[model samples]
Target: MKCWCGKVLIIDTRRLESKFRDDGKDGLIEGVNLKDRIERNMNASSYPFRVDDSCHIFRFTSTGMKTIEKVVVFDPLPIPGIYMLVLGDFDEDEIDVGVKSNNRDLEMVLSTVVKIIAFFLSDYPDASIFVEGSSAARNRLYRIMIEKERKNWRELFVIKGIDEDTFEVFQSGKNYSSYLISLCKT
Candidate 1:
């Protein structure tokens, strides 16, 4: 499959129906599945962000015979703080947040995270924030929360810290989520 952003997204479903049945999970939504199929057929793709160490845009070409020429490129966002948040899907969770960016400024990192949580919670009111790995991660996040509160930034109402790897996978589509999350750890 491909996204309009010109990035190839392939998900073979040769056994998906059987697997869903075996797991006793609800069937896939018809429109969503069809959309995925169309995306694959169209060979849509995108690279919303730049890949580090590369001067070129990420190109996603379809394996099929489609004249669809989708080009994906990176766009750097300016939030006046550390880190960036990208959205993606996971098998185990409905929503996940990852911190990405090497910027060591702790204040910017926390502010970015709070902004992400606030944005997501507006739609996913029941979503949880999962911090991964380090035991002290909770304490670090809390400290940032307190500081943000003092600075008059709205406190996030939902957060669950998990491990580093899980956050990494959820943030696969987003390149900056984990880097900022790591800044909070330090």
Candidate 2:
């Protein structure tokens, strides 16, 4: 989808996965951290997508704050289907979301994602994205952020969950999440 700040694109999970296997990376348009993700994901748990069937992406911005068009790839999970699940924080961590779909078209899915982000940018000044339904799920989110995003990724970092009850910030490589984390906490 097209937007004033950027464009969003989604492709089939099979196509995305194949690209990752071929090139060792796919990126925001497809996904990220291919080779490392593949090796690490060998034993990653898979969840039934029933709960995720209605998944949506949301973005937010604080009053008078700038909208940084950074896309964070969060909770990248490989489901047993032709797709990989992707969650991300965007507009400089002002927004958070996950994308899940049974649809076959990537563009449609991603267009919707872009629209959702736009809504957050245009509307909600304070909003929270997904947290695990259980403590373990939230903890898993933290570990995933630490393990995958702690490297060469330039402009994105996952928001860490503290104790699955309160949220905290952790430094990922060169990124200082204090400011961003503070925004998220509210």
Candidate 3:
């Protein structure tokens, strides 16, 4: 199945099932140190999400001045064990990722995204989730959200930002073209 982002989701169910079953002894990537974890308070709120049977897709409703159906898809990338996080509105028969729903619920939507990420990592602890916005402005928005939650999230994830093909530890004030997140070793 091909996603709206044009990336073909070649889901090998057997491979995924096996990966999910394996113990995550080697989950943490090299070069990440335990001292790098950040601690802070996270007081964000989110809408409850419903997961599909495959657990690759999640749905939630955004309620504010307007009601919008939202879909979050964790599509497999070409690289093994990596997936791209796609967020979009659930249009009829398709997910329109480019559409900007001015629902005035940015914080709730982002908080819900974080919740979904946590849930996805619980099943695929070693998998790295990639996120890149549909537009430059949207990318900036994502960066801002990440920065706001960086300290709180660092305790749970090893967040990295990609700039000019280089993946470095995510830092505030630095602009990145994309982001990668994986479960932090407990």
- Per-candidate Cα lDDT values, in order, are 0.30, 0.30, 0.75
Alpha carbon deviation, residue 82, candidate 1 (Å)? 25
Two-way TM-score contest, 1 vs 3, winner: 3
Assess the local accuracy of residue 177 in candidate 3 as a C-alpha lDDT between 0 and 100: 89
- The most accurate candidate by lDDT is 3
TM-score of 3: 0.76
| Model 3 C-alpha lDDT per residue in residues 63-125, reported as the tens digit of each score | 978888887889999999899998988654455787888889998899778878877886789
lDDT digits (tens) for residues 1-186 of candidate 2: 533367764433454223223232332122112123222423322111111111222222211133222232323224321122244434322333443222333232333332332223222334333333223443444444444534422122234434424445654332321112111212
Please give the lDDT score at residue 184 for candidate 2.
Answer: 26
Candidate 3 backbone clash number: 0
Off by over 4 Å in 3: 1-41
RMSD of each: 18.0, 17.7, 9.0
Off by over 4 Å in 1: 1-102, 150-186
